[model samples]
Target chain A: MESFNLFASLASAIVLEAAPFLLLGSFVGALFEVLVPDSFIERMIPKTVPGQLGFGLFAGMVLPTCECGVVPVVRKLLARGVPPATAITYLFAAPVINPVVLLSTYFAFQSDLTMVFWRCVLVGIPALVLGGVLGKGTAADILNLPKPVLRQMDDIRNENHGHDHGHECGCAACGETHDESSRIRAVLVHTGIEFLSMSKFLIFGACAAALFKTFTPSSVLDLMQGNNFISVGSMMLFAVLSSVCSEADAFVAAGFSMLPKAAMLSFVAIGPMVDLKLIPMFLSTFKRRVALALIVVPVVTIFYLCVLLAYLEGGV
Target chain B: MIMDRLHTILEGLTTALLGAFMYAFSISDSYWMLLSPKFQPLTATAGFLLFVTGAAMTTRKPPRNVRRWGALCAMLAFLALACWAVLGPESAFAPDPPKKHTPMSLELPEPGEGFEPRLTLNDKEYVRISTPELFALIEGTNKEYPREIAMRGMVARSPDLDKRGMIAVFRVNVFCCLADAVAPGFLVSVDDPDKYPQGSWVRVAGEVVESAESHANGEISLPGMLMSFVSLNHEIRGHDVRIIDPPDMPFTFEVRDKEPFAY
Candidate 1:
């Protein structure tokens, strides 16, 4: 194929395949804008430091949004007086800890629960570590969002007239027409906005992944094979480059079956936590230093941890 | 006030265009070139949802745009991609030049240790099996004698197979999407090369032969059939490589939901 055709084919493939999941994510992200009142999460959060970290680690089981959807939720959490650290913990935890993502990881590994377990452990450990560490500071310390972006966060929070939806019944049977429709509209508007906002990074990321996939040859991937430590870093680096969603990245990792299990684990683990596309999203929500910390903390933790696992592979 | 509404409208318009582009591409004939047909339903449904969401944005009140310039740039970027997707030539999705170097990957597909074969000796009249299913069968089939399986695939004249007058019959197997599609095929020994042209769709029925060579060793090496405990591939040892019309279903689905082929 001509370079352009190959480029188009791969780019379009990545974009189209991911569009549905991205849309679903945007819808949910948008819904969080209106339906879940700002005060709701703040109230639910346990006051204790450990409680907050624990909540972030396991919240995905209750709410199964992938990495793509978690950003918006985290942003919303920050806006609603949810501690930046706790919200950051949720941000890290939501992608891998989530049920849908876990299930996808399981199926992609040919129904093996082992891969799923490792994926959770790898992701859980980081979010657990980061949630408490990163979660320590105030919104300004934790979130270095540009002034305008921070203002937008406020705008999203102020949507309910700075009012709590607590008085609103949680049940659908209430048949509250006025509240429901407005709620629905708010969700849609948010969905539209979020999709438009995030898709810029998504399209660019997908295109880059395709171009890399198309132009780079097999020998390039196999370079780090047999060497578990480098393989882990290499695959993790690839994960950052591809920026594939956690729900679907297993298939991509599985593509390089030759990569050590440790490497594949790192690929899936570090991907949801940080990536090129996600960096911008993180910047939009976090302080520059804080965002840099989010990336550095996990990348270092996961890489070394994965390298350790790679060394221990035969011992166990 | 007017500027806010206009920004909202432009946002709506950009989103609507994105939704429309998705919907349009999903239905276009060239869609298969971009994504596997199995994903059509999901892609189209998403497009519909996006469209509805975009339409709703027109009436729905938007949070004030704190960053108007950024929003405008996003709108333009979204519009440009959507426009390109809609108007791009069909060749954009397929190869304009012959795909000379589209090696499936550096690594061979994972061995089918736990996978069930697509066909068995008990099953009569071999019909069609996807490349992945066929490879799995070769690796997992426990039958003592080769199963008489009939299958169809496009001819890939690979030098790696290294057998004269034999061609690798393969199908594009989509594990997740087109981006992850791998060309997995088995070798078919044919009597004539003219009848079985390269890239021609053919149906061949034969006694399955397992290769002694281990398969999926990163590099695909098919010496013949890698029968149950099958390392990687299986071979169709028959002279009956007949020309056949391409099957309607363009790509194979996940193994669990695979059947219901439009043969």
Candidate 2:
């Protein structure tokens, strides 16, 4: 009963924190579904590979959102002709750049600014690399949805319910003279649909994280605290599998005060960028091959950087 | 037509209930079980937005997209409610405090001869500190004589209350959310432990002194204190345990610029 209560509370807390971010991200996505045209997004984005990758890398920081919310928004962007590289870059790089994430990281480590600076440097490198490499192909070449499913989605996008929504394409995407009420209604409908579609991953991820933390013995973490290499690896694994929100992950890392600064730093840096929860999110949004690339590249890169830092600091 | 209509009704119901549940759970103060109270306001907003989105979906004809996809929402809803039900309100309330404890320790040089002059100094002045800070101060022991400190927190009787002759007082130290909360404790040795019962809110004002014998998992520091102070020991303790009103927020942030709230 005690273990159950402890796990349940932890899981519930994660859901509670994620709910608003999910809603906000989905709401923006739903709005994008109608208000922004495929052409508009295409035109706005830089066509050159480097330009797209660069834009995606910095987009999330400027936007300032959580990983939970970023998934859906990236999915929407992909659906609307956003380049895969741009979408993937935003996917990986956004977490570290976020203002809330940075601030939380600062306080969680007892106002140590070095961790935050190092985190930004490490996260950006992999994110840019992943964006540049995997983003080579277009959505048609990269995405693995069945022909029928793709057709269905596209048909839904192009549907005109005999009601006038715009002047040219019968959509809000065109320079349509939409009444305030109908526009709001369209926004609501789109937001509702997006919310319904994307929320499952968030919920499942939270539950998985809660159970992982509850069952794993604190002794396991305590044991690994001394060896810098082993401790850093274990902490990073904990950070990813734990799937706690990036904004709140710093606190989670701090709770393990027994671990060295290197272990703690890796947990904070790697978590916001990618994790178990984001894996499901990636699968849902990108092709299976691309999703694998996304997870593998980021994880492998972070592991080395963390190990090197541990060697330098020498944990107490 | 009938099948389509039935599906619409089901989808609308699911969306509405999930949204309503988020709002209901948040408003009930049950959210403290899941996240930090600092995020209390955001919970309310999330609940409202979810409800609004659901209400809109209920109005659409035939619930067009409600398919196998909707089942995921059900799964999500079930997981959330299940967790909430298992973890009751008293999850944070530790009626029976643990016997063993781990306090903050650092490598500081031992105290020199003129460090304090007196082993235990008695004074009227009281310094305010969080439980963790209190642990740090006691660990360092630079002053030599214990300083008069006042701390507010939940009081729990140690399992070896009679054998050990002390009570454990602590506050749940939260960094970002409840998930990362750690309890930093201080064992106050009272003349009569029965006077202040366990699980009660009170203010303990006392000067923590170095223990005579080696305690549990005690280690000596580099320079200052010869013996490592694992447990809390107060020479001149405060008998006047004032019972105070528990504040709206039951957490202690305890960081720089972030004042520790009454917990």
Identify the leading candidate in terms of TM-score. Answer: 1
lDDT of 2 at A147: 41
The stretch of ten residues in a row with the least summed lDDT in candidate 2 chain B is B219-228
Worst 10 residues of 2 chain A by lDDT: A167-176
Residues A1-316, model 2: lDDT tens digits: 6566666666566555655655665555445445655455456688799999888877755464467567655665666678888987887777667666677667556677887787777788888898787788666655667445665775665453322334112211122122335777767655565555545544555566566556655456446665877888877887777666665566556655556777777887778667776777778757888778777887788888877877874421
lDDT for model 2, please: 0.59
- For model 2, report DockQ: 0.25
RMSD of every prediction: 8.4, 9.2
Local distance difference test, candidate 1:
0.62
* RMSD to native, candidate 1: 8.4
Give the total clashing residue pairs for model 2: 6
